[model samples]
Target: MPDIREENKDIINCVLESMQGFVVTDLDGKIIFLNDRYADILQVDRHEVIGKDVIDVIPGTRMHIVARTGREEMGSLFKLKNGESVLVNRIPVRKNGKIIGVAAFGSLSMLDEMSTVATIQKIGHLSQELNQYKSELNKLRGAKYSLDQIIGNSPNLIKMKELIKKVAQTKSTVLITGETGTGKELVAHAIHQLSTRSHHSFGRLNCAAIPNDLLESELFGYEEGAFTGAKKGGKIGKFELANCGTLLLDEINQMPLYFQSKLLRVIQEKEIERVGGNKPIDIDVRLIFTTNRNLLDMVHQDSFREDLYYRINVMSIEVPPLRTRVDDIPFLVEHFISKINKELGLNITGIDDKVIELFQTYYWPGNIREMENTIERAANLALQGKLTLELFEHFLLRKEKERSRNENEICLETVRFKAEKETIIRVLAQTNANVSMAAKLLKINRSVLYEKIKKYDIRTM
Candidate 1:
């Protein structure tokens, strides 16, 4: 299991991440909010573009001109470094009838990836209330990360990276199996970045994050007004948007059996039909499926589709959990510390050998993600000098407490399930069986809350 926080981070990812790439600029045309898609398109990163001048980054751009004049510009064609041009529409953002910022939207009608275009219109129609209706837009939209991003020197990690590199050249569907926080998503990005379709869009859909009823429409898309609350002019699906690229299905084991058959059909046919449309649209996507559960065990239990399992298991890679690779802990800690130092603008030195020994001895059920979070937390508490065992007393003390708990807790999985059961039951009881209210109180999705209620066999009190 990964750190619960890292797992929950999926909740922040946008449903339509990277489909549209846009930039916002203050009145002076200083760049802000550059989506990962546009960063890829412009051949620049968010760090370079954000707070940067529009003309300095993209010379001859009329964004500054429009900003100063307080006028809107549409149908502006700009040539990218890749020689493919993007169609952009720039407009002024108003606050209390005064221009505060400029928003640029690329043409969704022309681009198969309509990710960013729909945002401005939604904001325009809803004003400040847009945030009230939707989840956060993907701050780190599915971008193609490379193998170099992975930090590990252990034998297992080296082998895993090599296997990923070898499999990336082929078009086979990949099934990445690992504990939560094992960098499965990062590996998927590395594979896509190394593949031939690296230049195209990369989109992801968390099977466990989305509600079952809406998963199909999100994956296959929908026709205009397909449903009662469907957005106008229809919307593009992840498959179509990532047609020439990759679509990572995170937590694939959680996909409902009802949709599994449809997914199998689309994968076999290499075409997708919108929820309400009759026409089948051809799509060429590199499918990468990830799971923290054993799909084979699920297949035996009849919870997962055998045919779909085999289809996705064409090339499988099992990543070793952090605890299993103790030799890599020091290197991983150093890497995380340096990265954290840069991120927080701190000059903290690496941990002492005694602290490293404790890290190596400790069991990390949350894997690398947990390690990073813990490192950051400990670093934040550090006052002066290298992080020592005393600085990590919070973790050291917790380990000691867990050691005492081990005899009573017995199986970790059982303890985890019981804890979850109790928490859900308590929240539901407090909410008087109102799923929405319970979910709000728990700060989780209502659908997710309902699922847990049923999973735990908790009756409404």
Candidate 2:
């Protein structure tokens, strides 16, 4: 028995309440109307909330302010009393184009609730993936050497460690100069491990390992389509990747002269422009440059830039050659023996006294690298729990003989070359120059035999 207008109003109310949760407030900041959905979202009884201050009913509601200001906020994140976040629209209601009240429409329907939950779970999954990626990246680029890994306690070693400690406290560029195999990169790693930025990345690039044409791209990165065969999606350069971290450029003397100017500008400007890109990105990187060659001499000879040399020489550390630190030879020997034992799974206790004497007397031209190789060889041959003098004496005698022969220009290499040439000639003649048969007989690859034939100038027919 209800009239048509009353039935239409009821239908409209039911439709609006089912589709969205909404609350209305008057200019006096009093809640005038709210659906059951809105009341449930606020966790309050619908009847009691009517005529109450909107702020009191909903702790952080802005409906009352919107009613007075006649402003609209769409798709804003509104936190509910239960710590749930919902997207809401706070819209002002106008009568005859004059502000009257405000309505807040919230995403509180069942569909919206499910969507919000899904979004939260997606964000959590992405966060976990990001953290895992960062862990792997740290392992790849992190510093692997600490001060204790230097392994010597001689006066020179102690002096060098002290210098490392002092320099690690600053942010200045470091230049580490030393002979090849003297562990210059180890010093660079130690400085990074002790510095304030130890918790961040430590990136290293060997200038000599990269070709001259590709060094710039490796250091500064390149954009997609920067050149033929460029990697897609561009690449992050060393400076950008090592931002707020340390970057070590080993064998910097091998960097081409043309690229040195570019590197100088980057050091001075603290920014780099990717190849095929116009914008210069800022970088905060601590630089450590290492070189075996004397950079100052190169500068004087015009092979290296004087400006670049002075700029990088701000704080220099000269790692002494192993010969000068022979006082620490015993310690070095013990360390190498223990390391080799672990690697080879051998229980060799130690080296004999005569072996240590020989090690101290020998001029190690190859430095620690050569010493390590020698120790590993000895450890492989050692028996009865010790490295004896006999284990290394023959190796030393052969090395001495080789050095003498080299000085007289009659080394084993010449003898072997002559013998190999004669053998190849004999095999070619025996086989009637059938390359495959000759290669099989000599136990060498066919291509190798062909190269030797070409070198020896043997007639095939």
Candidate 3:
């Protein structure tokens, strides 16, 4: 019987060694025996921890509960002195149906095997959060109308949105024509976002901004040494960058007449030839062109080609000027204020009613661009609370003065044209039959005024 009891004790010790930290405490909460693993986890020697008060080492309500209840508690997170989280399991030890002591096992926070299961759980939660965030980001990126991004309640703007949605699925050429500052570029971006090509690049070029000499190189690529200062390596242009995507040609009317022929060919053939190169590169591009100028009038005036105008004017979308959509001013102002507040990091709550009233009454010549600029300027100058009418008075007065000056100038020019035409005809009649004298008096080519004479139906008398 003595030998069997000793064997059982050895078996218990071996099993405790294989398991993590284990502690056996008597009913009085005194530590009777502690495993080497348990001592190592607490950073103390096994001999020093043995026969000590368990409450003195692990002082907490959990210890009192285990001593009183004699029940098992499993997998609870507890903070250690070093600020690491630990998982603990407590079991009541009994002999002959009477509870003698409590045995507890604890796993340290940093052990690799114990944390592997926890790490996988954390990673799975993070992956789920990432997927949800990606889905929300895509929705925001593709939205056309919202509270502060796009502002309009007018039927016209609603119609424009419907048309944009209708054409977003097709790979068609779009021509946006409107007065300057009417948000043509905004419409272009909305179309691209709604389309399948939203994942691809949306490249833009201002045709009027680039100089004529550089416009060709900007639209189509150039081989090395194509020009005097050409890059050593061949350059790829906007067309190639916009391939399999969308390209916005702003101020398309300002494209040089010479380049118009080349653009026309590219549009028709769906290919482009690099400058000084013979190879024609095929491109699958969706072209979106914008212009405030009337291309038909330009074609009639010989300033733009008729063929190119028709080619690019495939599906025309006319963006109405802000003056024609005055009912949207309130929504636009609120949107601008929200955008400005976010950008300036201000906590502005709202705009004054009187300030919105003034905006509704004002004629925005520069349209949305002018409105945004004005709002930005006011936001920078405003106090931390709100924007008031008094803060925008100076800007409003400035715009009023500019409008008055423009009107006066137009009147003066009209008077000047009548006076100049009268003087030229009189001078020509007085110096009649002498072409040199007539040219000298008019200070212009005799042929030039003669053409004007026929143009204005002013015969030489």
Per-candidate TM-score against the hidden true structure: 0.59, 0.59, 0.59
lDDT of 2 by residue, 1-461 (tens): 77999999999899768745788888788888888877777789988989999899888777875775567977655667666666678999889999888888875433446677786556556767988997787688888888998988889899999999999978999999999889999999999988878768999999999999988888899999999999999998888888999999999999999999999999999999999899999999999999999997677457899899989998999998988999888988888888887778888898889888877777677789888988888788874388888889666885687567666676666888899999988988898889899989998767667767887786788
Q: For residues 81-193, could you state the per-residue lDDT of candidate 3 as single tens digits? A: 44445577787888998888887776544465856558645655676797788667545443243222446978888887788887776888999989889888888888887
Each prediction's Cα lDDT score?
0.82, 0.85, 0.78
| Native-referenced Cα lDDT, model 1 | 0.82
Tens-digit lDDT track of model 1 for 1-461: 67888766665345224455577788998997777776776778778667888878776677886776677988665555455555678899999999998888667433445564465445445644544433233224446468998877789889999999899888999999999999999999999888766656779989999999999899999999799989898999999988888999999999999999999998899999998999999999999999999997787567899999999999999989998899988888888888888888777877899988888887787889988888888888883358877778788887788677765667777889999899888887887888888888888766667667788888885
Give the clashing residue pairs of candidate 2, or none.
none
Off by over 4 Å in 3: 1-148, 402-461
Q: List residue ranges in candidate 2 displaced over 4 A.
A: 1-137, 398-461
Total colliding residue pairs, candidate 1: 4
